[model samples]
Target: MLLAIDCGNTNTVFSIWDGTRFLATWRTSTEHQRTADQYYVWLSTLMEFLGIKAEITDVIVSSTVPRVVFNLRVLADRYFNTRAMVVGKPDCELPVDVRVDLGTNVGPDRLVNTVAGFDLYGGDLIVVDFGTATTFDVVAADGAYEGGVIAPGVNLSLEALHQAAAALPHVDITKPQRVVGTNTVACMQSGIFWGYVGLVREICARIKAERDRPMRIISTGGLAPLFQQAEDLFDDWREDLTMHGLTVIHRYNTHKDFRQ
Candidate 1:
């Protein structure tokens, strides 16, 4: 079985893959202080409830928060007795070529997303990831990782509104019935939701115009579905796209004849 861990800035997800398919997945808030015992306890209890049992023989990890990777590494080594494959390291062996300036390090999550997006769509693609920061990455038709844009995430915007403004309260994002809001909550929702729709559409349009190619737009992350409902900017949404990428990279590295 393969234990795949994707550690983001806000959340860390763990899943077990039993060679053929994913057995189960669980998510929790990312904490740098979490120990090997803490991970083992939480995962064992959760997997026991779901009736998925396995001896974790292999492990793979992709992390946006570099600080938490230490705990993840310790957990993998101590509990599973395996050294996890850490993405973004020089020897990680990604399937895509990243075209970036020297000394600039691309985020592991972005690279994983590009690899998965290129594998599925054959490049000329745009991947919008809605995490702590909204990232837009462009993959060329030939699987080159061209850089893209970054926007403030929806949740961050809400929090900023509450913190900076005196009267505004931090509210959940939702699609409002109309563009014009009748109340404070409605106004906040409309601004956040509709504003993102416009932002996504405009950025995609500009990217397409600049590249002059028919690039497929792929949206992922927690807030993707919510924004997708209000706009047709994205061609597809895969909730487990990052997980699929991790699995693919793991297989490629572990198996000599992975293609077969």
Candidate 2:
């Protein structure tokens, strides 16, 4: 079995892949200070409760938060007794091409998403990920990554608004009853919700026009379903896209015969 760990800015997810299919997945907040023992305890307890008996032999990690990598590496080495293959590291070997300016270090999460999107959906595509920072990644027909856009995430935007303004409270993002809000919370929710719908629509439109080609839009991340439900923004939404990518990358590294 392979242990795929995707550590994002806000949360970290663990999925157990048994070659043909995934068996279990768990999520927790990302904390750089968490130790290897703590990880084992939590994971073992959950696995025991779920009656999962598969042994984790290989570990693959895709981490946006670099600080958390060290402890995760320790977790794999100390507990699983295997070295963890981290995305973006030279030896990890990706199955896609990354086209960007020289000396530019693209985020591993974006790269993983690009690879996963191209593998699942064929050609010219725009992958919108709503993580700690909502990002737009453009993928070429040949599975190459072309840079796109980055905007403040809905939660981040709301936090900024609350902090920057006096009298405005931190409001959760939700679809408003109507465009025009009758209360302060409703107004904030409308701005965060409709504002993002417009942001995603406009950005995708501009990207498609600039590329001058038809591109399929794929939405991923926790907030993807929310926006996708509100409007006709994305063609598809895969909540576990990153986890799936980690599995693909792991297969490529171990087998060295990745099919597309």
Best by lDDT: 2
lDDT of 1 by residue, 1-260 (tens): 99999898888888888877788989999998888889989998997888887899988999988888888889889989999899997657887788999988898988888888887778799999998889999999888799999899889988899899999987988889999999999999888888889999999999999999799999899889988787777999989888888887888788746651
TM-score for each predicted model, relative to the true structure: 0.96, 0.98
lDDT by residue for model 2 over 1-260, one digit each (tens)? Answer: 99999998888999999998889999999999999999999999999999999799999999989999999999999999999999999999888888999999899999999989988997699999999999999999898999999999889999999999998998888888899999999989998999999999999999999999999999998899998888999999998888888888998888886577
Worst 10 residues of 2 by lDDT: 251-260
Q: Which stretches of candidate 1 lie over 4 Å from their true place?
A: 256-260
* Residue 217 Cα positional deviation in candidate 1, in Å, after optimal superposition: 0.4
The clash numbers for all candidates, in the given order, read 0, 0
Runs in model 2 lying further than 4 Å from the true structure: none
| CA-only RMSD, every prediction | 1.3, 0.9
Q: What is the lDDT of residue 160 in candidate 2?
A: 95
